[model samples]
Target chain A: MFNYIIVGSGFAGSVIAERIANVLNKKVLVIEKRSHIGGNCYDYRNKDGIIIHKYGPHLFHTNYKEVFDYLSNFTDWRIYYHKVLAFIDGKKVPIPFNFNSMDILFPEILSKKLQEKLLKKYPYGAKVPILKLKKENDKDLKFLADFVYEKIFKNYTIKQWGKRPEEIDSEVTARVPVCIGRDDRYFDDKYQALPEEGYTKIFERMLSHPNIKLMLNTDFKEIMKVDLKGKKIYFLGQEFKGKVIFTGMIDELFAYKFGMLPYRSLDLHLEVIEKEYFQEVAVVNYPNDYDFTRITEFKHIHPIKTNRTVILKEYPKDYDPERDIPYYPFFDKAAREVYAKYQELAERFDHLILVGRLAEYRYYDMDDVIKRSLEVFEERIR
Target chain B: MFNYIIVGSGFAGSVIAERIANVLNKKVLVIEKRSHIGGNCYDYRNKDGIIIHKYGPHLFHTNYKEVFDYLSNFTDWRIYYHKVLAFIDGKKVPIPFNFNSMDILFPEILSKKLQEKLLKKYPYGAKVPILKLKKENDKDLKFLADFVYEKIFKNYTIKQWGKRPEEIDSEVTARVPVCIGRDDRYFDDKYQALPEEGYTKIFERMLSHPNIKLMLNTDFKEIMKVDLKGKKIYFLGQEFKGKVIFTGMIDELFAYKFGMLPYRSLDLHLEVIEKEYFQEVAVVNYPNDYDFTRITEFKHIHPIKTNRTVILKEYPKDYDPERDIPYYPFFDKAAREVYAKYQELAERFDHLILVGRLAEYRYYDMDDVIKRSLEVFEERIR
Candidate 1:
């Protein structure tokens, strides 16, 4: 009989299992539905002899050194900085907007003037909410905010967030800071890097330990039938005792009592080119006049130079109940209300600790996930 | 005659004009190459009276209080948070990877076991890499990561990045972090909000200062024919005498001396639905098995409480010199080499300040752009 049963093998479940077994020094059983492990941050070689991120381009950037260092133990470290470009008007511009982009897309004079104007407008230590001098009657920097939102963020937001500037939470804008200085790095962090080896290797190392049991191609729902010792946790709704840890969606765990939460789905078109190298950058964003929001060049992320290359065309799609994988959770009032109900139910569990992206319904970086998991162990499990 | 000439009425240009004219009491003339004044961030009412971001949906999200506070002066604030979904194999999963996902896609038992395995192996701070993980590895964390990358990220990355995981830089993976705790809020920040009225209005206010002059449907290339009081700055073969602030691409500024950088472009398929609302979330992503990458419902972004709705289907394409707007910059070694040459030439301009997304050749968020521009002003212009 196992002392603990955890659901899913992604960061959430993996973290929980490792912590519990290590702290309690008890027998732990981890079951995975897929043939392999790692929920979404998995990487492996394909038939085409290309090492690809199986789900999507999973970039591991974090500000927390501990999380960074922790994951480093699993995989080798690579000094990679995430660079993105936006394909607009037949020109390649850096993603998030930057210098060096001006002359490529715009005529010289126009580019120069625009730069000067931007510099003058955004002085150092400017305060939020950006207040435009002209629209005095307007509050909350609506006028100037709208202007930036339109050009810098709007269409892309519509494509990525599936909403307009007005519909999104104000916090969304807060996440993407407007820079007064000219440094074009995707993330603003002192410590940013990627695993030299694939993220899969890191996960493999994290999971490869003794005093643990792993079953692949096995479903937790089926395992629920047998009586198990200890507490049972239903991640995907399989009954298991022995301190069950659920990492799936909270609403799904409760069977969508508050109506299905809105979620945006995606469709990706992947192709390989015979050229030794493809695009100049790793990721290219489509902000205007594009069916796809972005294109990713695998070579940009992985560091292996080869004669052949692979790429993925990212297309946004509507969440379909019948035929799609839900990637993003819609935290609209309706969804939130539904989630709230599930949260109540989840809180009722005594031994079960609901954690991870799925359990919490929040988007987190890899480091954040580790930090959060560790926090849970420190506060509850331990 | 205008005392100061400002090109491009986008946020970058408008903000500068407004600040200099309003605060510094300087006369400014604004010129826009596009027919409209707001540049790429233009939004207006269509025939249906439904507000549509002309360029695209721009969701304003930032972390800097100053940037947000500055925009507050121009317009009112709106409170909205966006959600995204992924459509794969006929399933809708929350984006950024969340809990409610496994139930609809994987079988109940399998999903539960997968969760268990993840927890068992990971076991909170295993301090071991998944790669080094042994068969007794309870979490199979690495395997799960591989599974996610394969099922979702792999194909999508190939379509988005144009390179395989092995070939790309590790930095890409680091940028996308996995979540350990479930919170499904795509971004975790203190402040999240948007512009109340829209983005275009903000531009109008920012550029409406008395010291600023406005010109639309005019290109700086045409204006270069007239003389300005400044040193002669040569871009490729063209010469300019005014203090030039470039916001275009670095390669084009140098006339693609090292050869034009490769960038991916997009083709958008738009549809105007006559319904008040459509879909559950705002954005949806398609990882693989689709010609297009994703679909976006405009109402999710705008939420105008209208009977009319708009949506866009995104498709990725090879950037053609003649068609499509280049959105992302390709940072291949060749392009970088060419950019290096351009950089050398750019240094000759004592009065010129290269700014915006293109001039820098680096990926920048809106905050980054604003911050960068401000830095240039403080260090160089001031």
Candidate 2:
């Protein structure tokens, strides 16, 4: 009865489902394992009117005006710039480490001298990568690069990745950099804001079209089957003619014909504190002191008047597919080869499409996932 | 030959002259006492290709889209957000004092507690004036207000105005505020940028029309005369029929008819340092230490590659009518009363219109002067 069968209700599956149903005026069914939509972006307001993300802190910021303009149709936006402070040497300094961090952490004379060298050597607002900065030949610059790596990036990388600083791949090592300017914002996107209503409300508006039907608490595997040999899809014991957009893990769709792709998960411990506020900012990273990577207080994100505040502590761990939610895909060379194999196998079935962080085995921010989904719809589905 | 006469080449006069010349296609003459145009906004490139402001730093930033749009016709804008730091307790902190300043100045525990109280009490990203904040009933918030006033505002006011902290009027005390959030930028305006070309270029473009005649090194009092009792104006032995837009000092134009209005002038000490750069940011306030109020490095504003840099130290002093150039009209109760008499006397002449900081006897920023000129053109000139 439906023209398209979406295997997940995340941004990847939902955006395409919405376009197909509204733009083409065709019937589409969305299947989901979770009771709600919005995938990792899902957030709900508690009794105290504080919107809390069920998974973790998800901030929406993008430089693409098209993406922002497209999303503006569904929800009103509130100006929000995310700020993070990393606990280093008994003081909390803004990260990705910048000149302000240099001032708070170093001695007055040394800090001023270091700043002079940096401004002279680099552009005023350039973000110098830790790995690239480490390659600098200048004595003071080299010292600064090393000082940043050892004091700030080293311990954080170990806790988040479960590997020594040197063991991490060079490509992954350059992700965090030292900002030359004093902008303390975590992300320097041109457009930064949160949905005025919440992310869940945006999903509700996108899927409210008459041609769209949703199935909660129902996994696609329960009613849909992929015949690997024949390269065909079957739905409810009948040969399904509709295209199947798979957003779940690519390896699982073929029933682990080759092997499982590696992933990292998190243990989110949420607590209710009997105080007006838990911290100054929304998130604070304990790089050197704790097992948990960071603590996020929801009151800062969605301001409220209640005295009781909620804070979440995140503990990174190896992904256990049987229990934990897969948050990030492992990006080492070996994992890429395994993911390429699954991608090749899925291409053989013309009706099967792979998208999202899980299906593509790539890490995507909220705006990145939406941008990819919009592009895929034009290139493949349309 | 001129249908309108403008007394100064500042924003207030130039904007009016440009409008009358281009929009109305009428002849207008601009009489500037200074040798060059652009008055206080004039800047020139030194031998090292550094664009140095002759008077002081003049940054353009405005929230009114119309004002930005109007100025966009003359020159391209370079995104420039002014960042300032004040030396307090041997550490440089951002001011208008913010949460970042609080973190660096106070003990960590005290800073954290003060931040919590501030966040709970005030809206994020608010510029709460020192006078208003000092009236807070909450104990922690009250302590924070008093602490900020003593550390950042008190001595700076004394240095700039040459008055004890208690002697300064309440109206002037509220100008600087404690920002609730950590935006280190001196301004939080929606549009903040500098002209890619020097500000003098803007004035050159403004008065470039053939109908706009510029009279350099000529005081308006030389060719123009105002009869206060008769309410008549004569230009060069002829009865001038058109409106005379006066941007010079109101007291000087009327020859201090009632009494001399007080003004404060600056002794700018421009030094060319051998060093590549002077300080981190463009401007740094020496609140407690230096004889001068602040030091401004020109290279920081207009970035260029040169070993030698230019810095200006401003020493505030009482205005001398015979030898000194008036920069600011002293705003006190007695000064305001005397200024009002001149204003009332100016209103008696139908063809005489007064505008700008000097004529209005008020402190007007660059944007404010432009905005006022546009309004006056619509209301009085156009």
lDDT of each: 0.63, 0.85
TM-score of each: 0.46, 0.50
Model 1 docking tier (incorrect/acceptable/medium/high): incorrect
Task: Pick the lDDT winner.
Answer: 2
Judged by whole-model lDDT over C-alpha atoms, candidate 1 comes out at 0.63
Candidate 2 regions off by >4 Å?
A: B1-382
Error of 1 at B261 (Å): 66
